[model samples]
Target: MQTINLLLAGFQSAFELAAFITVVVGLLVGVIAGALPGISFVNAMAMALPFTYAMGATQAMLFLGGIYVGGVFGGSISAIMINVPGTPASLPSTWDGYAMTRKGQVKRALTIAVTASATGGLVSALMLTFLSAPFASFAMRFSQPEFFAATVLGLVSVIAIAKDKPIITLISLLIGMAIGTVGVDPLYGQARFSFGIPEVESGIRFVVVMIGLFAIGEVVDLVASNRDLRPKKTDGKPERVRLRDILAVKGAILRGTGIGCMIGVIPGAGATPGAVIAYGVEKQINPRGAEFGTGVEAGLAAPEAAKNATTGAAMVPLLTLGIPGSAATAIMLAAMMLQGVNPGPLLFIMDPSMVYTIFAAMIIANVLMIGAGFGVAQMFSTLMRTPPAILAAFIVVLSLIGAYGVRNNIFDVYVCLVFGVLGWAMKRVGFPSAPLVLGVILGPLAERYFLTAVANSRQDYSVFFTRPISATILFIAFVFVLWSLWPTLKSRIGRQPA
Candidate 1:
């Protein structure tokens, strides 16, 4: 009953003019960004982060929440229309969705994709609303040790998701953690990697690192490759979607949503894995599995549902434990911190109104995404017609400005530029940047929690293992790592000569 009342109050707050408009604007920005090849919604979020400073904490979350929800679905627009995935999570869409496009069923594919995405997101948002309070209650028992363990679990889960190339991912993650340690030590306040540079002592802001890595690198690549962004016209007449079309794939949508919700809450397994796994699972279980890649509606629906479903599920750990699961959520975390708001169990207790308002905004965003998706799909060609050079220049300027805006410091701009070049190089080499960004965001939190736990326990490291919750979480991390690597191990062993 209390939860019901709180949610009602939340809806009331979310319905306010400013919050409603913010969500609409953010949804538009996200859809446009996600539909454009090479310019992802994550990049759009990073660039938009600077603009959030003027918003209230609630409004900022509403804005970003709208973007997060809308962007996840927007990627499929391009994938279906042009055989190009605007975001990595949209990769599966290019297979079945583009197949549908080639068959002149592009409209049918889009209807299924958007409908499934909105439904999955709606279910996930409802889950976030009901499940978060209970999770927050559970999290109230967590101390520093448990928090540290949870952070570790988040870090290792990144490896699990990128299991195909764990070594490279780990190296990238470690490099990010090393970068995270460049400023004053969290506990001791002593600087280690400053190298006598005063600005360096304050540490590199993750926001700057994010913009440098995601935005600048992507822009440079688009410019250098000179890839044409326009969507090719399809030959088929647009098919009208009926309610029967949606009913036919209901099972796939539900299964994908379930899988996405489960994977999303794991802290590091994000939408990309969720989508891929859904596609894989749907292929195995659906009766038409053998026909998956040839414009099967179920195939397109499942991954689309899974990817958008992840948006709300990924927020579970962030709101309950303050652990960010992906780059997008990490940026949201940065926004919260910048607004002087700390997320976690106490956030629920201290600010239920704000928490529930975010929940309400998420629900509203998912509902509104249908309209936003169609609007952008219509304008996609016009958006693509903009010159790549002009777009690249605009992104570079925005990124540098975002970096400089961190502390209003020019040195941060230089740092951003340097990392931008590094990011471009890393991209060229096929190194994963997501894990590195996750490491930077989570590393400092882990350090802080670990040091505090040890210090509170008289410097005894065993305190982590002594506690049941912490130990259990660590054990889960261990098992998760083994589970993630087992396939590779098995394949390698099978390949060995007798």
Candidate 2:
């Protein structure tokens, strides 16, 4: 009853004209920014940080919360339609969502994606409203060792996507980890593999690398294949969403939401890992696991749901314990500090109204995201109607701009071009690049966490196994790896002569 009253009060405050408008505007900006390659929602939030100064505390949180919800889903727009993930979390979407686009089911793909995303985010928001306190306690239990174990789980889970090519996938992932190591040593603060170049010492930005690998390689493929992206005519009838289609993937959505909520509360494990882990889990469980990359609806829906579901759950640590779980939440923390608000258990008692109001805004944003997603998706899909050369040119220009904008350095542009060529070449040879990308994304986090855990534990290697949580997470990763590789092992056994 108390929770209900607090949430009701929250809804009342969020519905006020100023707050509502702020949310709507933020939602639109986030969706557009996320759909554009190179300009992620994190950058959008950073750019919008100045504008929040003009608004009251609650309104400011409302605006950024709306963007947080919308941006998580926005990346899927490009991933599904163009095979370029606007964010790392959307990489799994490209495997299945883009496959659907290739099969001329863009409308169906978008409908499923938006529906799953809204459902996941809505559930996450509700959980945030009611379970914040208990979940905060759970999140607090995670230390550096456990965090390192979670990162290892994320890295090992990539095996599910290897498709019987585990050796090659492992090699690709290792190469990515190598790339991630080029900047500075996390523990020593010394640069390695920079060859004394200033830009190399600054490290390669993953966003620039991501844009080059997916966007540039995709445009090259588009120009080379001469594939037409215009909507296909099907006896003068447009493909529509079926009730059965959503029903078919209901299990995936629920599972993804649960996984996302669990992962989000872990400080360093953000939406990217949540989405990828969801995809890997769905592949292992779904009956059509072998057909994951061929446009399976469950494949697309699970990750879409998982990524957006992380939005509200990601905020729990920030709101309850004054800990910023991810970069996005860190910005929110800055906004709160700028407003003279300190978030902690005391904030709930002292400023319950503001806290609950932000909760209400998250719910509203997720609900509103459905309409925003379709509106933006419709606009992006029209780009498919353009000639291949023009479309390719547009993608390349956007890719280049995104690369250069990473740090406003010409050297980053050169790195992106080098990666672009490598991506295209890898694509030509049918080598998996996603694992390499994952390696780059998680390797640094794993290294930082592992080093901190070890250093803090007096260089004790047994610290991981000594802790219950860390040991449990590492054990799970081990089981997951064996489970993922079981099919190949069984297949080889079947082919052996007696």
Instruction: Find the 10 residues in a row with the least total lDDT in model 2.
Output: 227-236
Task: Estimate the lDDT of model 2.
Answer: 0.90
* Residue pair clashes in candidate 1: none
**Cα RMSD of predicted structure 2:** 1.1
TM-score result, candidate 1: 0.65
RMSD of each: 6.9, 1.1
Q: Highest lDDT among the candidates is held by which one?
A: 2
Q: Give the alpha carbon lDDT tens digit for every residue of 364-410 in model 1.
A: 99999988887877675454457767756755775676567667899
Give the lDDT of residue 494 in candidate 2.
98
Residue pairs in clash, model 2: none
- How well is each residue in 1-498 modelled by candidate 2, as lDDT tens digits? 987899899999999998899999999988888898888988899999999999899988988888888888999999999888988888899999998988888888999999999998999899888898999999888999999999998899899988879999999999998899888898999999999888899888888888888988777776677766454544567878899989999999999999999898888689999999999999999999999999999999999999988888989999999998788899999999999999999999999999899999999999999999999998997777788788888888988888888778988888888888888889999899999999999989999999999999999999999999999999999999999999899999999999
Best by TM-score: 2
- Per model, how many backbone clashes are there? 0, 0
